[model samples]
Target: MQSVALLLIGIQLVYAGKHSLQYFYTATSGLPNLPQFVSVGIVDGQPFTYYDSKIRRMTPRQDWMAKSVGEDYWERNTQASIGSEQAFINNINVVKDRFNQTGGVHTYQEMYGCEWDDETEEINGFDEDGFDGGDFTTLDYKEKRYISPVPQGLATAEKWNRDGSLQQRKNYLGTICVEWLKKYLEYGKSSLQKKVSPQVSVLQKDPSSPVTCHATGFYPSGVTITWMKNGREHHEDVEVGELLPNEDGTFQKTSSITVTPDEWKKNEYSCVVEHQGKSVTEDEIRSNKGDSVPIGIIVGALGAVVLLIIIVVAGYKVYQKKKGFKPVNGSDDGSNSSAHTVPQA
Candidate 1:
């Protein structure tokens, strides 16, 4: 019940009034301190969705998306397209059709968002930042929050909106974003394996001290920084920090604990960091924060039952040897034992 309530709260957050959804896919070739790939849809300040390159599909549309974009748009572009291989590829072309060739650190992003405007009927607006051979460009609707002057020497530039641009009519926009997302998912995490290890440090103010285990400049956001005492995770006096974005697009975090000088001298404390996998295929998963304990217990129980079945089947089997025969007229093999002689009242 608590989880369900929290889920409702979370869903309401993005759809409450109005919010923005920023879709991003990035790939890098040379940055040592950045994530190799990033495919995410950030709604307001939280993660609303992401692309799954492994399966070549966008995530399930939140309720907000259905209400905002209309159900048909959500199903056709995000669900149906990714469900079929050819349709998925066609969707990828939507991004490729607009993006420049990839090299070095390439980033592709789209801004399709909604807001509660009592004065304005809800209309989806889109903006995109794309990489070029040696430069970058922005394409967006006129109503977007950020609008820039077109390049000095561009032959043509196009900006489309549902009602604003006048030249291009926004049609099946959700479908277009899906394909653009596919393009981003293709290369965004190309540098995942090339991540730079965080610079970890334990700091204390005095000899007997509260120490801060600081980890900075690590790529791929879900890195876990843990403080261990004598090789075991310690939580009583430990503080694990959150991921802070570096100016360079990499990430940083810190975990802290307090200990006596004697404990410090004995080296009883250490910091361990677990870096997550990078690829989307065969490696991507949804992080369910509240259900871990119950799910683990359920899976463990099921495993024990399966192990019991294996134990029984692995035992030896006996052969009948043709010596087996039905006793003539139901006679026993000299071993008929009776514990009762009729039921005497």
Candidate 2:
């Protein structure tokens, strides 16, 4: 039995590391200032293409994406997004009516993507929809059906299933989506596969404030920031923040812990940041306030300044699917938002 369990564990490990390609679409109503429709294309958590109702054109966010694809690709995707914009606008209104919401700001979002495990070459896909900051429907790819979380989505789910859209979705998610993902990966391998170590720092306003451990300028997004007390893991009063994108295309995150000066003096508290298999920790900590300093160190005053400009452009794609807004650089039109493009699968 132990050998069988070990074999299972080993099998699971074969599919551990995965690369994903995803597209996010958001349609909004009742917000005159913001774009009514927005779409974004992402590969391995990096935004590559963006389109909004205001721009009315599909633009490449990454240099590799622009250099690899030609004008026809952009024209094709741009036209598709223009069509999807109208469709999604109708979808939002449909959802609003189903929910009996006559007015007020509402958003309808769709996210579909595929993931490929590098080691095992295993592929998996997902399609989900959200309405007004909540789940509406999700596709069960294995069963080839749509699952509705709310009563308002039941009709949409049944109609989609009855109209034979599931088979089309299944084909897209399994085959076409994976093919596009592979192509994108090939085009952007140099940038996508490159990993950069994070700059870790511990900061505090004064002896009374919570000590914050900030990790910034890391690539590939996956990271772990933890607090340790006396060499063991510390959990109490620790607040882990959301991952935010830096202007330089890297990612930043913060974890803070509240401890009294006396408690910190009595115990050895340290912040550890693990990114891309590298661990960073500082031992000497100093504060702006003239208090008895801790043994650990504080670094990156410059990073703290950069953090002030760090705006959360992309939403938590998996967690809070409603907030899918990203601003493109060098846009004078004052219209920055999120959107999507529909590819025939």
Candidate 1 has its poorest 10 consecutive residues by lDDT at 307-316
**What are the candidates' C-alpha RMSDs?**
27.6, 10.7
**What lDDT does candidate 2 reach at residue 156?**
83
Over 197-279, each residue of candidate 2 has an lDDT whose tens digit, in order, gives: 77766688888888887777887775666677876788999999877667788877899899889997798776666555343
Off by over 4 Å in 2: 1-16, 277-317, 322-345
TM-score of each: 0.31, 0.80
Alpha carbon lDDT of residue 1, candidate 1? 16
Q: lDDT for each of the candidates?
A: 0.33, 0.64
